[model samples]
Target: MRRFFYTIDSDNADAPLLPKLSELSQGSDIELPDSIIHHWCRVLRANVGDQGILFDGFGGEYQVQLQTISKKKAIATLLLHLDDDRTAPIISKIGLVMSRGERMDYAIQKATELGVTAIQLLSSHHGEVNLKPAQVEKKLAHWQQVAIAACEQCGLNRPPLILAPLSIRDWLAPTESPNNKTAVSPIVSTLSKDKYYQVLESAADLRLQMSVPAAGQPAKPEILETVLKQESPYIELLIGPEGGLSDDECQKAESVGFAPWQIGTRVLRTETVPVVALTTLLALYSYNK
Candidate 1:
């Protein structure tokens, strides 16, 4: 069976009335979203009685069977609920500096597959891309959709939230709270309200900055060893752009309690940092067990 993300849009009158997937009951027939209709009905040529999976990013997924199909509309009947979130063992939020073109998409896509809880888009002094006011909405939506699509492909039931872009200075400001309403993603703000997604709003248990490999730096941050000892630890990772963070930006991040984490002797591209960093943590986690 094919899996599809059932995104919520409370602001739209035609959107589903229920915000969370858990609210939907078995044996109920529900209208499919436009995105799903296009992919499953028209493009895939799915017919009535075809079965598939639907997830709303609240928690679990549902087994559904197509009941109706039309050019612009489709309906599926919920058969059963599968309570498998398939989330990563650790909760993480990566403060990723924007890159250009496919690099940005690759970062978000791979991060979602690795079970990142949230991503905070940052524009640093050495960053490649910075969105203007007009570009923010479109770009943010595009990135969020990228994460959603990754979830559909990777069997991650709960999609990671892609936050709105903020400057490195503003994001690291002592007075700035991570939960500030201004930084909320437009796609998630008005849609589902899950407690799991709210975890990123709070301060993380550990904060690590992916620093360029420098001589005399510890191979692994001591704090990482300490944090992973706890159950389901929450970590915040800072990854810079292609050229890496400026001296001042790095110093500011250090002042804000971000410990330097140099993975290996080799230098990594901006897009590759997330994948390597996440897998390293997972490896460490398994070794500790």
Candidate 2:
């Protein structure tokens, strides 16, 4: 069976007949999202009785069977709901600097596959890509779609929220108290509206920066082991750009409680940091548990 992300456009009158997943029941008909129609109906040439999986960025996925197909529209019937949760044992949001072209996409894709809770897109002193005011919406949409496609391929039911890009300085500024809860990302708030996704807005239990390998830096942060002991520990990671964060930026990050985490002696490219750092974290989490 193929998989499709069921998107709802509450403001669009032409949205699918079943706009909300709550409206779905076994044997009930659901008008497939437009994106799915193009890929499944026209491109794949799907036929009646074809089965596929569907997830709405909620907690679980659904098994559906195509009942009707056309050049412009398609319909599927919900077969069953699978309540399997494959989220990471530790909750994480990477403050990833935006790189150019495929590098950015690759980082987001790998992060999604690793069950990241969210990605806070950042523009650092040496970051390459900076969206103009006119470009923000388009780029955000493109990146969000990138995350959605990654979820479809990786079997992650809850797509990590791709937050709007922010300056590293602003992102590091302590706006909220450690105990204060911040507001959810506008993107997730508009599309998801789920309590599960809201957890990303809360203060992280531990914060780490993927620091450049230096002689004196510890291989890993000391607090990481203690933090991973908690149930569903929320961690925030700061990864710099290719040229890396300036000395001033690094200082600010440290002042705000981001412990320096040096992976190894070799320097890693901006795109590779997330994969290596996340894999290391997952390994540590599994071993500690």
Candidate 3:
């Protein structure tokens, strides 16, 4: 079934009276985004008295009846507070190096569709395009459109948060948030003097960038799984560019204690590692689920 979710203003309580009146009651007026208005009002042929889902994050979904309609305006009133059917357990987040051209777009779309909760774009030393503020804003807007399109197609009602543009270095530095949020860095590795991976870490769990070699001639998957077992409490993937991390960058990462382990006998593309890492952890986490 096609599913859509929206938040309703609690001050308006007429939504709950829909079923009793047998007519949709138009309540709070919300400004629908242009693209959505086109689709919902025109393409979907959604008219007054039609049903949809609306809710607060309070865990119950409000079954709503569409109350009013016009060329560019519509509203839905809450009907029944139905419990949600699906649940997403994994709190997956990706920290990606900005790839050039359409590849970055493709990665973000795929990653969001795959259920990433947040997407953080990082500019690494190996990044190909240097951005001015305007350029970054332009790209972020495009990226958000891509995410919304993915949500529409993938049935993801809750859109993932797209973080502000940041560099690998600046993103790693500690700072205060308006919400009184604590410092959070996701990328981690095993300790190794040679391989560079640790451009990101947290004070509580500082050992994220190390790669652990297996006890025997283990499979690549097996080695990664064993290594993740020793993960320092959190897992934030740090993916480098096509040319890979620079020697100096790698050395700097290593100085902060990144464990560099081999993924395979062959080299993976810039976009491939993070995808694999996401799937791998999801699979591992699913086993316990």
User: Which one is best on lDDT?
Assistant: 1
TM-score of 1: 0.94
lDDT, candidate 1, 118-204, per-residue tens: 898999988889899999888988999899889889999888888888888888883776554445555566443668866776889
lDDT of 2 by residue, 1-289 (tens): 7878776553254543345575677788888767888888888888898899998876688999999887777888989999878888988999999999999999999999988888888898899988896887678778888888888898888888888888887788747435432333333444545688667768899999899888888988788999988878899999999999999999999999999999888999988999998898899888888
Q: Give all TM-scores, in the order shown.
A: 0.94, 0.92, 0.65
Task: Give the poorly placed runs of model 3, Cα more than 4 Å off.
Answer: 5-35, 54-62, 85-88, 174-233
Lowest-sum lDDT 10-residue window in model 1 = 183-192
lDDT of 3 at 199: 22
Backbone clash count, each prediction separately: 0, 0, 18
Q: Model 3: how far is 260 from its true place, Å?
A: 3.2
Better of 2 and 3 by lDDT: 2
TM for candidate 3 is: 0.65
From the highest TM-score down, the ranking of the candidates is 1, 2, 3
Name the lDDT of candidate 3: 0.52
